[model samples]
Every structure is written in C-alpha cells, then in structure tokens.
Target: MKILIVDDEVDILTLFKDVLESVGHEVDIAIDGESGLKKFRNKKYDVIVMDYRMHGKNGIDVAEEMLKMDRNTKIIFASADSSIKEKALEMGAVGFLLKPFDIDQIIKEVEKIEKN
Candidate 1:
C-alpha cells in the first residue's frame, strides 16, 4: 500500500519508513502536518499514518482538511496521546494506535486498510 507518515520526530519517521519500505510498501515521510497535507494534495495514498500532536497543524486539523477533499481518505492515528482516539475516529480516522506500540502493529493497520 502507498502510505504517508506524518510526525514531528525524525526517529519515528525513519523507523516507520524503514519498516514499511522493508515490507515492500511505498512509503513517504513528512516531519510536520502541513507538509503531510501538501503531499496528500500532490499524490494519492492508500493510508495515512499520522500523529495526533504535531507542530503547526495537528493531526485532527490536517485530517479534517484531507477528509473534506476526499471523504474516503483512510487515516490512522499513531499518537502517544490516547485521549484523542474517539475524536479522531469521529473525525473520520479509520484506526488509532497509541504510541510506544509494536512496529508490526502499524503494518497490520495499513494492511487492514488496504484490504478494505
């Protein structure tokens, strides 16, 4: 699946990109929500793995805009903050992964979305 990962942490970005690429998935990394949104506009991704807390635009804000443009967009929140899961889902996120989670969890989530 084509996946976009948006987060402020370089480590997180590199880790996700490495794992997703190793699994033969096309992966793109953005360090912030704005850039992630820009890439979303420029290309089509099967799923977006984003963090809820980010600089400038949060995941909710970005997802809201993305959903506006394409209501079918599949966004999964990979955030340390679990408090926003309900809100994220309500805002159209397909899944939520609380941080410090297993790397395989993300792959599974992406695959799950890919199947749908």
Candidate 2:
C-alpha cells in the first residue's frame, strides 16, 4: 500500500516511515499540513496517517480539505487527544490512533482498511 504520513514531529515521521516501509508499504512523509496537502494532490495514496495537532493546519483541517478533493480518501487521525476521535469520525476518518500508540496498532488499522 502507498501511505502518506503527516506529522510535525521528526521522530514520529521517521519511526512510522521506517516501520511502514519495513512492512512493504511505500511511505511518504510530510512535516506539516501544507506540505502534506501538496503531496496528497501530487500523488495517489491508499491511506493517509495524519497528526491531529500541528503548527499550521491541524489534522481535521487537512482531512476536510483532502476529503473535498476525494471524498473516498481514507484518513487515520493520530493524536494525544482522545477527545477528538468522535469529531474525526464525524469528518469521515477511517480510524483514530491516540498518540503513544504502538506501531502494531497503526499497522493493524491500515490492514483493516486494506481488507475492506
């Protein structure tokens, strides 16, 4: 699967990229929403893993925009704030991962989406 991961934290980006790539997925990383949106426009990804909080556009903002571009877009919102899960789901996110999540959890979510 081709996956795009948008997050401000370099560590998180690196970790996810490495893990996903190791599992045979093509992974792309963006440090902020603007860059992420730009990449999303330029390529077709099977899934997008986005951080809910960032300096520029937040995850919800990015997800909303991406969905407008492609209503079927699958977004997995990741954040330390569990409170936003409901809102993320309302906006059509396929999955929500609380920050400090296990890497296996992310893989499981992606696999679940892939199965569907």
**What Cα-based lDDT does every candidate model obtain?**
0.93, 0.95
lDDT per residue (tens digit) for residues 2-88 in model 2: 999999999999999999899889999999999999999999999999998998899999999999999999999989989999999
Count clashing pairs, candidate 1. Answer: 0
TM-score of 1: 0.97
Residue 74 displacement in candidate 1 (angstroms): 0.4
Candidate 1 lDDT (Cα, whole model)? 0.93
Best candidate according to TM-score: 2
